[model samples]
Target: MYPEPMSKSLEGKLVVAISSRALFDFEEENKVFEDSDDRAYMDLQLSRLDVPAKPGVAYPLVKKLLAFNTETDNRVAVVILSRNDPVSGLRVFRSAQEANLQLERGVFTRGRNPYPYLTSLGANLFLSAKEEDVRAALNAGFAAARVYPDSAVAADRHPDEIRIAFDGDAVLFSDEAERIYAARGLEAFQAHEIERAAIPLPPGPFKPLLEALKPLQAQPAGAPMRVRTALVTARSAPAHERAIRTLMAWNIQVDEAMFLGGLEKADFLREFEPDFFFDDQTGYCDTAARVGPTGHVVSGVKNEVGGPRPSDR
Candidate 1:
């Protein structure tokens, strides 16, 4: 029932919008303590217990996108934050104000401090949030939002030009192998992929998304999806067969694939100039952000301490 994939030419050209959770600091209410218990609940909610701690953990994904505004010359990004700021929050208001000041110096970052702008930030895209985060935001009286631009709208936005880039494993495929590499070791993961390379790999996590883009893909190259899809991943040749096969079996045509084999990907990305780049790994996102508009789709895992999770931590 989904729409077809977008055309090759209309891949990554469009306004890209991202989100943040802190826009301004909340004014702490004075409390007449009837008992110590009253302070306990208040502290948990308002987080007034820690002066240095922020109101909300600034989602590293947001920072990654913000970093894009600094480097990549293509695609505009608008960052949205919650109006109810958290003390431990990522200083969303300060960042916005500062980014505003830098704007005169030619810094072109966009800040959506007053949450309402999210729906109309020229891109109309919201980010993916964990179920718990979405619920908590709503439960705590914050607005529940989701990324807009279903395939049709995305196609319409760039009907004549789009350049999409996908990060191999997690962003395009399931994280199963990625989990294996993390849990068991590269040797074991590589062995598993070699064993099943001929069996035909399952559709990726975003396969449906690719299928939905088929319609857009069908149009003439000059009309949409100007470039065929590109897959960028850390997997090398022998370990990358399944990824290629899976796309082939799905009848998905990828214009390019770069197996980094531990090399830094930013250099290659700069040449590609993708309007939007998606990757599940923070390492790739960090570097790619310097080259283009990047989106780090949040997995359900709450290892979210803010910034890239330390590999050792």
Candidate 2:
């Protein structure tokens, strides 16, 4: 009898599922797709098969994450989970090869929602340009965000380091306090947080992704790549105490924390130069996108139909 084949697994690895549009600059082809149909888009991609797509907003972040992997140590896995057809997938794989991205797996749904595959892939994070897909992933209890395609490219200041920034409520922690703030006001929210300062806030959708990064962050000093995380939140003073204490309770350590209160976060993001920043409020995301790559976490009360605006927060 033949020997049993070795089983393949992504155990203990950080798995990221990224859409093609979020991974490459497919805006022109996407326009063709939107204006025409799948056939036209496939035809255009086929003709440009030899051409490599430019890096998108999330390229820098993906590149740095992949750097965690080594010949002997496979620390990360990035799979292309996109809506493009199999034909267009050729171009994506070709472009990744040209860009030196060691991506080897993908799933093409040809315009269908691909969030369901996240479960089988054991994905810790999912980034896509489609809000619907992002919502589905988050609803399914996975970390997901809608990428801002037009956002500025990441800065080259920290080429070897991956810097990620996240908002407090909704993005990292449950939006319980945010709902209180929305229904009552900032004063009520602050009071609630103060009352629960000793208690750790519940985990949000992105908490798992943050936890996955903890091991990567603990790598030895000689590792080729490093990760730096920051919390840039609108909460100030007493409210900040809960946020800090929450991380402490979870045993997660962030490199920096900025309690900006209600001040604009764009300027602060520009100075921090994170590879990507995530927030639940579109208004804050819109402004932050101008500085660097940003993702909109479509969770929490702030994202509801009649939710309060960023200015109100």
Local lDDT at 208 for model 1: 53
- Give the candidate number with the greatest lDDT: 2
Models 1 onward score TM values of: 0.50, 0.97
Q: Score residue 11 of candidate 1 by CA lDDT.
A: 31
> Cα RMSDs of all predictions?
13.6, 1.4
Tens digits of per-residue lDDT, candidate 1, 163-198, equal: 667877655776667666766678888998998887
RMSD of 1: 13.6
Q: For residues 103-203, could you state the per-residue lDDT of candidate 2 as single tens digits?
A: 99999999999999999999999999999999999999999999999999954669879999999899899999998988888889999999999999999
TM-score between candidate 1 and the true structure: 0.50
